[model samples]
Target: MGDLAFEPPRGGPTLWEIGIPDRSAAEFYIPDPDPNYINKLYVNHPDRFRQYGLWARYTDLYPDGDLVYTVGVSDYKTDWFFAQVTRKKDDDKYEGTTWQIKFNLETVNQTGTYKLRIALATAYVAELQVRVNNQNSNPPLFTTGLIGHDNTITRHGIHGIYRLYSIDVNGALLMEGENTIFLTQPMSSSALQGLMYDYIRLEAPPPNNSTKKI
Candidate 1:
């Protein structure tokens, strides 16, 4: 929802995320959704030079209702967008909010294994529904257990690395060219869970056949 990074590789693949401010307190918080208090959303397109093949959209919900936010490559904006999330009384999983993030690779030059990376601040058994293109009914490529959390170690917030792979749910390799990766966080432990996305890298594998020269 910020500067969606699409810079060309300097040496290897580049990284993208919300750059923290110089000072400590600059860290922002996504509070529990409430009617009286509204949080503004930041949505914008990448710079024109590299905007041809990237896009993103999401929807957040509060106890009261639903709010939608969308930003595309050609249509960029910096207006007031609000978001809210509140914990449920009876249920462990927060309900009603759905996030759909996609990358359109038809025009992208690079090809090969593009690893999808996802980072989260805090969660309890986060279910990541992944799909290629817009095939919603297609079974998720993979689902996460209690990852980045209490399963292996006792941690409260922010896992250093992401949990994702280019392979499908059936353990098959994802095809190169014109593919879109989708991530959906339907339910989570906290209220209004934050999905801090990292960069998706495209790596070209070695050629299948090779000839040795004398």
Candidate 2:
């Protein structure tokens, strides 16, 4: 063996990435603990997410509507809430929520399949449905049906079990200019049923010459 070399398989080129893939949502916005439910150990601490009742803040932050995030203009640290949870209703019931992410593309690949990579920091009896462009798509683009039991939200923890999903997006569903991706968590029996996203990314279709050995 004069020389030995190995090259890993290449997936595709990343078009855009949101949040860091560190198996935790710590990088995202972590609001201060409510004054009524403060944990002194976490006050003004980096692990502010560990404080109790952080999940309830979602309703307080956006009382009238759900989250609408614009890629270029919004700042993840301040705009992206750490978790996607249900909203409390005046009837003393909880309801599901849908968050939107809007982005723009100068061009699109008409004949190739794009990949949407989503990493979950934690989940608790939740179903995540993803829809591209068409918010009312009956079947949706992808769905994680009834996943996870890691009650990280109520336990005052930042993360628990980690999961990653790669969804194939048909090129035809994308547009040349403005596009929107909707993330819906449809399990609302309890406030604890939710998901914390670790990271999310979209990849352009691989080129014909994607594989190479060097």
Q: Evaluate all candidate structures by whole-model CA lDDT and list the values in order.
A: 0.33, 0.87
Kindly list the per-residue Cα lDDT of model 2 for residues 1-214, writing each as its tens digit: 6988865233588887789988989999888767899989877688888888999989999887999988888988888999999999988799999999999987777677888999999999999999999999999889989998888998878788998898998777888889999999999999888999998888888876332211
Q: Assess every candidate by TM-score.
A: 0.41, 0.91
In model 2, where do residues sit more than 4 Å from their true spots?
1-10, 209-214
Best of the candidates, TM-score: 2
Report the lDDT tens digits of candidate 1 across residue range 44-147: 32212121111111223234433322223321122111111223545445553443333332222233333344333333344556665554755666556333
As a whole number from 0 to 100, the lDDT of residue 73 in candidate 1 is 32
- Tell me how candidate 1 scores on lDDT: 0.33
Candidate RMSDs in Å, in order, are 12.1, 4.8
After superposing candidate 1 on the true structure, give the runs of residues whose Cα lies further than 4 Å from its correct spot.
Answer: 1-97, 106-111, 148-179, 188-214
Clashing pairs in 2: none
